[model samples]
Target: MTELIAATGSPSWDMSRTREMVRARWGDKALEALRPVLRAVTTRLIHARIHFQDYQRLVSEHLRQPLEAGTPWWELMWVDEEKGIGASNYFFIAAEGYVYAGVQAQHAIADNLAHVLYYSLGWNVDQRIPLGKVSLGTVCAQLARETTNSPELAPIQQALDALSTAPAYQALADVTNHIKHHGGLPVRVGWGTSEQTPFEVLLSAFSRKQQTQPPREIAAFLEETYDAMSRAVVTTGLALNEWLESSVAPAPPDNSLHQDSTPGGQELHPTDQPARV
Candidate 1:
């Protein structure tokens, strides 16, 4: 399964397969106990990947406008330039939103999974972890401490460590924080000479910090980030599955903690069979 997922070059999860593994090792109660949070993580994961794909598609399809060598930064235009003033602005603005939302969703996946781990370990509300905030770094730090003493959680810790150290993780966090706390992040689309294509359509962030640096293409960066997130997702899923296989039955879920988090018409329940991306 791991080899197949890697070969596809895209992240995929088998929700029903996970449920069957849980049911066979533990019972139906454990399956139900974990379903809600798993579904929430799934929601964020899918959305993040989908947003990235959409951004790539939109940019690739519309980056056909021709520009000369001396074209001004403000003059190099997106596809909708013929429409009027501010019409082309929508193109870049929408692309910015896609990247922002995609990064934010990737960050949320960690929190949703942290919630899963928090309950799986039977930590009570008296525990001082700030589960409500949007700090992946903070939640992951607490998880590190909790998992350090238990050899059973070693695999989970490895996944967390990989995610925390991933270049994409920190880069996305910086961009997310800059947008949320500092100020606006403007998206710039420009043309440059390239060996592969006549027009190298560059999508990049604009801020005071980046102003001193040369504008570089971000396609590789975004692709790297997405691949890193995919690896984390795959590793985390396998770790959880293995842990469930060796563990005792989990306690029944507190009904109050189970909320309706499923989006895109998907249900929170998982079946005996494996699912596809």
Candidate 2:
């Protein structure tokens, strides 16, 4: 019977493959736990893509100007001598209440939706973290502690705490970390692989430090930082997008209607027009 079972040709599965299978089989529950975080992540990703496109456009424009003028290409135009030519980068810091509120609200709504899905699917809370409650209180306590010392951080910290307690936040955090570590463009930018921006440098530094931290602090600090980073990146991205859209050059006027002037002050007009001596 053992030999027969072994002969059935079932391929061995690795942990990642197993997890994927489980996720698929219990997608509804997983999604419920993930929707809020995923939605937040999706919005940020969209913002990032827009920012990257804008940055590319800016570089293209800078490169095109000298070429269009029939002038020798200037390396200085393509490279900011001091800062380097690239899109400005930003991140959401919990110090900014308005941006934090928006992110928290989106996360909260996603959490509620996930809870509804979980309840509808009849999944047992014991099988997973009761993200709807357990984690919420923990985050609230942490926020209270942190805010007691810094009143300015109160509102944003409170909002972040609310989102942190949600299972969806965890799911989104996992996804974002994975993407950053892997090959996603946002992560590539975040890691300082694109153009060097202050935010990119900070994120890259954080990523390197995160690998060495203990698990508990890693979780806590990451949760604290995620919203802040998101806001900064999105703001920077939007600004760059606006700049690119507004910077487009107007089409040239009809050159045929004008006359060219020589160095000796002689004018040469088109054959159809009377020449000025």
Candidate 3:
């Protein structure tokens, strides 16, 4: 039952249950809370509204064929299981700078599809990325490499290149590690509330473009920002560990004695005592 969805432009059903689990984990309140975070991340990643629009256009073109053909893009990511407790499906739409997970069984497939469609078209866009086969990291790297020719991105590329020998890239190698290893660089102050959300971290890493000095200034900025983010991740990890320990520990049993007893031999506490004379 696997198929590629038109809007998402990727094979689905592989992670349907996983998607549901993520949605469940990020309940309605959490999801609503995440919007501001996502917006912040988007703002940091994109320098201008025009660039965002261009990115959206690129992704839109990729999805147009499937939509026009009336292909079932929604079904590609749907979970066929009758019961599941975790996220089993997930997909990314580069046109929109956010990922969607089916938290509830009743999430309107058509509506979700339409939302992604409109997002690709940039009808009401904020931020986006250019369509491509490579992962977002590779895309970002490519952008950095290409920008070596541009005045704006030249410093950014230089700074990033200097750090190629540093351990930062090792942590940033994968999505989870990047998020977990680098948490709160000023560039990525607010992206998502997830324990290891990396949107902001990546944005901060890319912000080396804003440095005023040449190679030295850019290098310093990259190192400082990476250090700051790595520290934040360490702090967050410690806090999370403490919270998990408290949550998983069992509560102590109640041991208070009753002060009053009923005529029927039922034990009653003093708070349930009759009025005093």
Candidate 4:
């Protein structure tokens, strides 16, 4: 069974985890290596927080629904009338910002982490096509192949191996792909015939301006998926950090990463080091 309860005492935007991700990806002396990417990731996550706060404010202030802190909104129908129209109206109006922000926050988290993962493995992530264009599994497979039969890359290989099988990582990869590539996320909630979890809002539900409940199992699945993703990110980060620190060999150099490599291009000059955090 999944751990239904959330892990304790972590903020939604875990700065400590953020630091860990960067530090672990590069060793202590190489903070310079992670500077630019960290700044970019931090900026994105901070924007996510702003969106989340705005969303929560709207939901708390205008909606009549009796919501418990941290409760997934899909459970409201089970607690009261089957998909109350009044509640749905309040939800649609008040929770719009929350839904949008929620999705954006998830995207930012996935995006930043994906970059870190790419960089940690000694890839010239700066030269590759945007990672969002590629799938997580493909990234892992490519890394595994690059690291094959090399003892120095063993730790990196181990981390990659675990990520290939991790449930949380897989869930995150699936959801991120769906949100970024598909029309939109599909959520199910139980009511007369439907239900929803706090994080899920069915695109179809809103499109029809009505409710459709699936089953508690589906809601639970969504909840578990998000929960797993949260845990998986930290796990992947720690493994990455370990890999970066443990590898005895120097990271592979790529000419493409040189600030001056792209002649006349907009890349930062070689003298302009990425600033320290």
TM-score of each: 0.68, 0.23, 0.19, 0.48
Per-structure clash totals for the candidates: 0, 10, 20, 14
Name the candidate that leads on lDDT: 1
Over 4 Å off, model 1: 1-5, 8-14, 17-33, 65-83, 124-135, 201-216, 249-277
Candidate 4 — which residues are off by over 4 angstroms? 1-33, 39-90, 93-96, 125-135, 151-226, 248-277
The residue pairs that clash in candidate 1, if any, are: none
| lDDT for residue 52 in candidate 3, whole number 0-100 | 36
| Cα error of candidate 1 at position 261, Å | 13
- Which of 3 and 4 is the better model by TM-score? 4
Higher-ranked by TM-score: 1 or 3: 1
lDDT of 2 by residue, 1-277 (tens): 0110111332311212212222344444553453343233334333333433443344344433434555434342344636544322221221122222323433343334233223222233343435545333443454467568756445434444545544546544544443346532131222122232211211222332345311222222333434434342223223222332333234322324322221211111111110110
Lowest lDDT sum, 10 consecutive residues, model 1, at 267-276
Q: Which 10 consecutive positions of candidate 2 have the poorest summed lDDT?
A: 268-277
lDDT score of residue 144 within candidate 2: 69
Better of 1 and 4 by TM-score: 1
Model 4 agreement with the true structure over 1-277: per-residue lDDT tens digits: 1111233443233333333434445454334444455344444434444555565455454322444453444545334555565665565544444544444554555545555566555454354535456445556566667566655555545554565576644543444445466555443322232334333333332211133322223223334444444444545555555555555344443323333221111211111111110
